[model samples]
Target chain A: MNAPATATAQRKTQAMHKNLQAGICFWSFLMPALAGLVLFMAIPMVWGFLLSLSHAQNTIHPGHFIGARNYTDLLTDPEFLNSLWTILVFTLFIVPATFAFSLWLALAVHSIPKGKAFFRTVFFIPTAVSYAAASLIARMSFFSGTASGFANHLVGLFGMQPVQWIGTASPPWYWLVLVSVRLWLQVGFYMIIFLAALQEIPRSLYEAAALDGATGGWTVLRFITLPQLRNASVSILLLNLIAAFQAFDEFYNILGGSGSSGGNIGLARPPLVYIYNVALSSQDFGRGAAGGFIITALIVLFTLVQGRLLGFGSKEGR
Target chain B: MATPMLTTPVTRRQMLKTFVFAGGALLSGCARSDYIDGKLVLTQWYHQYGEKGTFQAVHRYAREYTRVNPHIIVKVVWIPGDYGTKLATALLTPDGPDVFESTLTQAMVEAGQTAPLNDLFTSQDLADFNPRDIALNSVNGKIYGVKMIDDLGLLYYRKSMLQSAGMQPPATLDELMTLAAKLTTPQRKGLFLGNDGGITAMLNVLPWSAGADFLVNSQIVFNTPRTVLAYQKLQQLNQGGSLLMGAASDWWDPSAFTSGQAAMQWCGMWAYPAIARAVGSDLGAVIWPPLDAQGVPVTFLGGWTAMVNANRPHVEEAKKFLQWQWIQNRAIQTDWCVGYGFHVPPRLSLARTTPKLQQPVPAYAVNMLGKYGKATPPLWNAAMGSDLTNAVTNIVKLGQPAAQQVAAAADMCNRELQRELE
Candidate 1:
């Protein structure tokens, strides 16, 4: 072989050897997580899809495959329909409320000249609280239906009669409990995310806007601040939307009867809760899997529609 | 960067990859059952009872059993939080409990998770148990579970409240309604049948109280005109602004009654000791009053049962332990029922002779169990129960027409029954 060719061959072999070594290292690092994902998530998900087509109930064994039957049955199932409606209603209110509230808090916190870190930590503290504990606190102290409840006691100061916040079906004051506890538990995390995104916005943009006769805070926020936050807001909105749809812990813990008997969850039985009851309580794994896939499809569809409507990935303005 | 570095063929990456796979395999393998001292180990699962001493008692029983049968070591798994769901999920796995305590239903039998215990029971032992319990636990005449206790559920009312309101214990739903309104004061509400507004526990009892059955020979019959009328009456209670709603705990806990939040509560006999300690003789219980003239008052009988997992490797040993614990060990059974929580011994002989049960209140409960106690129908599974709850919620809480809601729920339940039949 010629000298240049020999050197080229040697370098090519070296590159190949280097690439192979890098590949091995990458695989070594990735394999553990990949295997876990396949075992715990991917495999079960595929099994669940199979289960959705079956008449299988309690047992993991897919006894019989009655294709499309569980899905069709779910379409007519009143409990499933009610749960879907409940989650849809919940998501509609919660997503917007959380987005606006978190954005407002982020803006307010970001604008603070001093003790910003302290306030940020204070606001973010609730994110660390488990949904179960927060729901319990809401039920036991704040929105308790008794006359001695915190909310009731506050209302009594204005000569208002004690309200049955949770138990009353007429007004559905339990919504306040469910919505407020969720907001308290999740708002902080979303707020921090918004705050981080806000900090990344160039200071020059705000200065230029201020110099260009945009003196009012509202005007600056309306034109620049919100538009700049599009990406972060979309992310937060999508996350909140998905999270709201999957709401179970707060509703289940607060409204669901004490953990003695498997709680009497009424009025606010979301789709996840309904699926859990079907899968776990009734041991109807087929129906549960079918409902789960329906919910997954719903979420994906909503996210896609939202992305398209908002031009989420487009860089038209940015 | 050099040719020698590449050509030397470093194997660290490969070794690391191998290590990761090996570690995962090792960790996963540890989950399999282990033998100690070459003894066959059997794991039994039990739901965490709210009653004190239940954990210790269960562990002690397991230890005692192990001591007697040295060849087999019994491991007691105290499962808390969603025990039913957990047990059901666990039963799907090979490593699931050998024996577990839960309400024995035809679903368990149909699912083939539970082994029939008829072979373990003597005819005399079968005769000793409450026939209603055996029938409820049986599917197609093959008994699947051994009854551990018979929990009596009825209405607990405060004597002072009743006396102040000038009311004898109510005999019918109408009278109870009137008494509720009259007994309700600024400090206390008239009744609390759980925060679900009597939809959770009392809904099933109401239909029976109204002289209606949930299912009669594979036919849904809970939506009769009488049941509709009875539910409508219950709707009045929900709308009447007299119920103590949204207590800290549910109806299962005696706190609502003990704290005087409710003058009367629908609760089980398990709360007797706690109520006595808190209220001191102020508590009195009665069977849920009838709905109309044709109806008779009813009390609910609910309790756990022991069954060997049909899938367990040690099914025969599990069944032997069940027979030993629940059948032969009458003292253990009595202690389990009455020692910690006030449960009526399923054995009529033990119930008759047990000292704690012969007390005034307990004796009254025992009498009610004999006279009015009804085991839930075998057809009334969890799914059907949830459907009935929805019907009650519709009829009572939402003020939906009783006939329509009950009919809809009953239709759904009948469909479920048909599915189960299939």
Candidate 2:
């Protein structure tokens, strides 16, 4: 009996030693990434929150603490409110348009039996282009208000007047320029995501639908493909929504100009641009930081609402 | 599967130690490279000027400074785009430039970003500089910067276009509007303020031309009826479909006027060289016209000013460099002002003596500046400027009521002024 008890005790010690080794390995692997997150992200976030409450003008360090005043000021200010409205309008336009275009491209690519890789690569090429570079192309080449611009030239061919694509605010033609550039820059990335999800749908599922006399392509697509793509569609929508909220580079490059001569054009200004003008241009860091936090909260609330409406993480969603 | 080779396992402690050692080595290497044996390194920044030889000229100036002071090496940083924003952000950090060129904004002074430079100039030297330029660089009776060059904003019109249309250089707001409308053609618009229309450059011009000031004794004063009327006239001109909108180049480039996209453009005297190169003997300039009989012709004076960074360790050294380069070096100043691009020297003595500025267009610009040039008030901060810009954009582009927009802007400016006071 004493020998058996000693053997059991030795086994327990060995198990304990193995667990200790495992714990060390786990922490050793995670510490670097965790340290980086704490240093770069978590610390800055806490500091930014602190800054949002203070009058931090022309300086990053917090000054006089003025609790929620910055937030309240932004809420009441017409320009800030207008920026919020502009972002909302932008998201409404960009999310649906990008979703549909990407999904269509993915479907078209998936249906192609030959040269599928070539077409995929061709469509994906734009995803590699920077937004600022694309905005320059859009502003200077495609939608320039001059008669020589591609859009103007196209309109001239139809005997239509050359429209001030970026300058005019009445018809808000700047929206067309902003949306087209963003779509061109981002659609390919979302298309690749949809393509992966599309390929993951089992061939047997389509076959089973066809066997049920759903021989029409639309019927098969509606019954099997659409339902199968729900998860991907929701995820893409979420990503697009987030991206739309964070729209800055294109609007800034195209509308804000070099920031040396003219100030912001005061049209099509998203939240980021407004914050940038307030914080950097106007040197009102307190309002800028507060605006940033408010925008973040808005994005979170929007994502939550969208996820709930779409059944994002429920079993049926998959 | 391939055979595994025996290797020593690494522990977290060992990894941390290695990282710390590597980091130390890298830091030491950087420090050794940065520290020249017995030389004092000073960094100076300048915004990228859009001229052919301006880049080389600035570097040449830096080289000349080093020659004058062999032990002190000056590093020239040519900031290309968004210089203001970049400079503002950099000024917050310890590693920012020791000396830089920018407008002396109230925020910069309020934040203690600029050092008082009263000691750099004597009474005679201060008297020699343009009084307006001196006033522009001063805050609460303390000088913070020395003017590098003065850029005069005025109207540049195609002589042939105006002649063919049987129009004279406009002297009043109505005449200018009429000339612009009459000069409009299928290939060209009447005027070009900028690519995004005229609100940016014309913001101050409108108020000044209407016999209004942005601030008077640190109080908001740009919401008068005459200013409202000026804004309305500007809106009408923008909507008249004659102002060139969204050109490939902005008003500053002179390409719009040279390419015949606009018959008249609101631009600065800096573009005189480019304009002469493109359209020799066919370019003419005038001050931006006033609103009515009561108002006066207006020219907005803008320029870069060199200031020493107050937060840096080498503040005294930076001040010494600025004094030597901008205040003491007359030949370098002349070359910088006129050699690359045409700019009126900020010093009255220099402007009077510079032969290049004695020519026809430059002389006229100098005269206009002497007569009608208005320097932006030191109290008019960026926040106030932004409010005014927004007001202009809304009134002109979105068809918002001019009076209402001006009032709103005035209210915002008052708030900003109040904050500054506090």
Model number with the top DockQ? 2
Each model: TM-score of chain B?
0.93, 0.94
Q: After superposition, how far is residue B34 of candidate 2 from its true place, in Å?
A: 6.0
Would you list the clashing residue pairs of candidate 2?
Answer: none
Q: Write the per-residue lDDT of candidate 1 for residues A1-318, one digit (tens) a residue.
A: 599999999999999988987897698689889999999999999999999999986776675999899999889988788888888888999999999899899999999999999999999999999999988889888877677889988998898877888866788788888899998988899999999999988999999998889988889999988888888888888888888878889878887865422324667688888888778888889988999999999999998998888787888574
Worst 10 residues of 1 chain B by lDDT: B1-10
lDDT of 1 by residue, B1-422 (tens): 35575456658766868688988999889676646889888888899888888999999999999889988888899987779889888888877888888987677788888998888878899899888888888889898988898997878888888898788999998899898889787667888888878777777688779888787787877878988887887888889988888788888888888888888888999888888778777777888998889998898888888889998777888889888999999879988988888999999899888998887889999988989887666667888877777777777767778899888988889888887889
lDDT, candidate 1, residue B201? 70
- RMSD to the native, candidate 2? 3.3
Model 2: DockQ score: 0.60
- Compared with the true structure, all predictions reach lDDT values of 0.84, 0.87
RMSD of each: 3.3, 3.3
DockQ (C-alpha based) per candidate is 0.54, 0.60
Task: Please provide, for model 2 over B255-313, each residue's C-alpha lDDT reduced to its tens digit, 9 standing for 90 to 100.
Answer: 88888888889888999988888988887888888788999998988888999999988
Misplaced by over 4 Å in model 1 are A1-30, A259-264, A316-318, B1-30
- Interface DockQ of candidate 1: 0.54
> What TM-score would you give candidate 1 relative to the actual structure?
0.94
